[model samples]
Target: MDQPTRPSKTIACLSALIKIGSSQAYALFDSGSNTDSMTPEYANAIRGPRIKLTEQVTLQLGCIGS
Candidate 1:
């Protein structure tokens, strides 16, 4: 079996999330990633308006967990 790859470097930083238009606060974290992304459920719950998709494109996702 292949061994999982490890991150080259690890750094700790303070995280902060701000609302789109208001001064309210919100935060979503994923230990696996330091990128700024949110789950669909969380987005939908906090989204303001919806933009209809004009195209149908297939998406392929990688393994969700190691």
Candidate 2:
């Protein structure tokens, strides 16, 4: 079996309450992250214009290949 990979560095995060449209939601802010993400349910709950990506992209969370 392949061993689980470990994170190379510690990531800093902060908890915050933010407004999306007229609704407020609790969120985590990651200082080390270069990208933004949210749950599919949350995305659907908020009112906004969403842009459909022409190409799907994959991201490595925490560390590379994680």
Candidate 3:
């Protein structure tokens, strides 16, 4: 059987960049070694850690502060 591919950290990093409107490249460090998943600006906006407890998919929506 083929092994499932884990979600790419690059994907998340790019997402954060797009969301933040930044042109620079970003990297997503592992959650195990990283304290947070968002950019510096986004880190402050998070109320708390967001955990996905199931296989259910969902969308995260938020506005970037200008």
Candidate 4:
């Protein structure tokens, strides 16, 4: 029997300093990512606008089950 081939991994990351509400923060940029996320504490600290979702959505992280 033949074995299935694994997909190639491509990782692209960049470190940058960004400004949020007059505050500067170090951030990592991923050009190939489909979604972006931040910690709940950081989100609250940024004091940015929040939108309530009509429905709950689940996200699947690579190598880490949701």
TM-score of each: 0.37, 0.61, 0.18, 0.57
Displacement of residue 63 (Cα, Å) in model 2 is 8.6
Clashing residue pairs in candidate 3 are: none
Q: Residue-wise lDDT of candidate 2 within 3-66, one digit each (tens)?
A: 7776857544578899888889898876777888877778787756688999997976665666
Question: What overall lDDT goes with each candidate model?
Answer: 0.59, 0.78, 0.47, 0.75
TM-score of 2: 0.61
| Backbone clashes (count) for model 3 | 0
Better of 3 and 4 by TM-score: 4
Model 4: per-residue Cα lDDT over 1-66, one tens digit each? 865775656444578898877778889986778877777788788787677989976876567433
* Ranked candidates (lDDT, high to low): 2, 4, 1, 3
* lDDT score at residue 29, model 2, on the 0-100 scale: 79
In lDDT terms, how accurate is model 1? 0.59
lDDT of 3 by residue, 1-66 (tens): 876788777345322333334334355444444233455465445443556657864545445752
Q: Can you tell me which runs of candidate 2 are displaced by over 4 Å?
A: 1-13, 63-66
Off by over 4 Å in 1: 1-18, 23-38, 64-66
